[model samples]
Target: MIDFFNNITNSLIFNNFFLVLSGLDNTILLLLISLPIGFILALLFALGRVSKIIILSKVIAGYIFIIRGTPLLVQIYLIYFGLGSVKFIRESFLWYALKEPFWCGVIALTINTVAYGAEIFRGGIQSIEKSQVESGLSLGFTKFLLLRKIILPIAIRKVLPSYGNELILMVKATSLVSLTTYMEMTGIARKIMAKTFAPIEAFIAAGILYLFLNFLMVQFVKYLEWKYNPHLRLNN
Candidate 1:
């Protein structure tokens, strides 16, 4: 028990908490950069998938299919390693971004996330009752009015829970970038383990940090759910 407690303290306190700080910052950067862009692109793709334009729908569908069908690690490698291999790509200005593992990881994460997010959002859009849509039309609601008032509100509410889960998944998924030599939480943990030769303590510390971050996210989502649903607020 004493040894376990000592190891935990040493892990957190080493070099004035370098491991914790570096890992936390990099992870947050990845989340902030990727999730917002991913959300916007996902929403656009979702809207495209639902729209009547068959060609747009099919193109987005195919892109989503490829992303969803492949593993994220493969996508990361393709971005970081594969892209830089092409002679034209190597000579091009875009190589500046592609050659850096961090940006490559961001690109891969954003692309991978948008696929699942698109599907989640598409489901939300489809969740609106057909009769409600008809009623809106009967009421002479303009297409703009119908979307702004009915579709947008209900669809967003429906999408929140699933979207929150995706956020949590993204947090975990950031660990994969460690393989690209980007020093996020797992990468930091690996470094600590290498130095201390204590894999268990280092990994446990990283896991605990992940749990804490996810807990905050979960609570924030719960708060959003409570705010969105007045009925739940009333029950309290």
Candidate 2:
């Protein structure tokens, strides 16, 4: 057992495996960038889902259906390879962006997250009481004002726990980006393991890094829940 600990430490430190794991900026960046962008688009999709416009709602529903039904790995591959394979795409101005693995990963992650996020947000928005809307209007609130103030706040509080889970899933999903040759945490781990022949130590260190990041995210979500649910906090 002591020898195993020594080997793990040696693999991490002397082999520079720890440095590779610690410097996971791209993985963290993918999560940070994709989360906000995906959520913003999801808010629009959610609004469309609940809106009076039949076409808008149906279109958003179809989008969510297609995205949610498909495998994320396939989605990433299609965006990275399938799109990149098109001659028009290669000739078009968009090629510059599409050719890069990082952008492809981001696009895939964003679209995937948006589908799940839209459903989560829609459920939360629909869960809001009609009386709440009536109350907001009675207080002279405009549609935008109602959404910005009462409706959005309450819906966010309702959906936060679910959203937090999505965020964690996204973090794990980033491991797939390694296939595109973007050296995120998992990619770095694979490379280290390949060179050092220490699969257990290398992968375990990588897992620990993910666990640590998710731990921070969980705490942050708990803080958001407590902060947003003031009535609950007050009652407690």
Give the range where candidate 1 is weakest over 10 consecutive residues by summed lDDT.
Answer: 11-20
C-alpha lDDT values of all predictions: 0.89, 0.89
Which parts of model 1 are misplaced by more than 4 Å? 1-18
The estimated TM-scores of all candidates read 0.89, 0.92
For model 2, state the Cα shift of residue 183 in Å: 0.8
Task: Tell me model 2's lDDT, rounded to 2 decimals.
Answer: 0.89
> Candidate 1 local accuracy as lDDT?
0.89
Cα-based lDDT at residue 91, candidate 2: 100
lDDT of 2 by residue, 1-236 (tens): 99988887765544555656554788988888888999999998899999999999999999999999998999999999999989999999989989999999999999999999999999999999999999999999998999999888989899999999998999999999888888898888888879878788788778888898899989999999998888887666
Alpha-carbon RMSD, each predicted model? 2.9, 2.6
